[model samples]
Target: MLYAIAAVILSYLLGSVSFSIMAAKLVKGIDIRQHGSGNAGATNTLRVLGKGPGIIVFLLDIGKGIAAVLLGAALSGQSDWVPVLCGLAAIVGHNWPIWYRFKGGKGVATTVGVMATLAFIPALIAGIITILVIAITRYVSLGSLVFAVLTPIILVIMEASLPILLVSLILGIFSFIRHRTNIVKLWQGQENKLGAKKGQ
Candidate 1:
């Protein structure tokens, strides 16, 4: 019980780091959430800062997810469900941070991170598909949405554990829910493209 609680806390804190926010502050002394698209993720970073900073933030955000899940796995060495809960907590933290006034990114990068850690093959497959979708469509939100919705499907196809599959399904649904605004923008054809150059 103690291990589970500790793992959840640790994972949440790890996810709450918010690399985009920190990177924006470090690179420009600004809050990324105040900029283009009003989002604090790689796509917005690319729009406001440039490709370099955006890529850095993306990698770092993904790293947070991976680190949180791995930490959970390490802490819950004896139990599988504990790590699943820990990984889910990390995703929750990324989406609704306790330290960021409950506002944070869409959690796509972090979700990719957690999924990758929990089920490497399925995650990698899903990531490849996501990249392809983004590259072909030029819509980051679309790619992320599809990826989020497909994670649990990939898990089932790959024959992952039932608990992991169930939690991943919940995570996927939540990720899509958080993208509700983007979904509307997408339907209205007002959604931003993946690449629009460094700045306006």
Candidate 2:
């Protein structure tokens, strides 16, 4: 129990490290949340910074999620829920990082990391489709939403364990909630696309 609690706390701390902000500041000396779509995630990073910094931040964010889950697994010792809980803790930290005044990016990248660790097959399927969607539409938010909605369905179809399904569902809801503004923009055909100019 003590180890599980420590893992969760450590995971949250890990997730709280906003790589996008770090990348922006390191690469261009600007706060990421003040530019582009005013979002501190990979898509906005790519828009505000460049491909190199954006990709690095994205990968690092995913890595933190994976690391968090692994930490839970190593500390909790065969406990089924601890890892998933740690994953959730990471997502929550990413979404509302204490280090960043509780203002953080949407948890899409971290969710990818967490869900992939928990249920690889379902996450892979959803991720592939997500990539295709982003490729075709150039709308990262749309692709993220699709992944969030599809992963739980795939998990259900595959008869995954309850905790995995539950976490996926919660993450799905979080995605929709976080992207509500983007959803409206998408409906209005005003959402920014990849490769577009900032504030376009």
| Best-fitting candidate, scored by lDDT | 2
lDDT of candidate model 2 versus the reference: 0.91
User: TM per model?
Assistant: 0.94, 0.97
In model 1, what lDDT does residue 98 have?
80
Please write out the lDDT profile of model 2 over residues 61-151, one tens digit for every residue.
8988899999999998989999999999999999899999988899889999999999999999999999999999999989999999999
In Å, residue 60's CA in model 2 sits off its true spot by 0.4
Candidate 1: regions farther than 4 A off: 197-200
Q: Which 10-residue window in model 1 sums to the lowest lDDT?
A: 191-200
Over 1-200, each residue of candidate 1 has an lDDT whose tens digit, in order, gives 78778988988988877787888898999998887776767678878888898888888888888888787778887888887887788888887888888788888888888888888888888889999998998988898888887888988878899878988888878877888887888899877776664211
Leading candidate by TM-score: 2
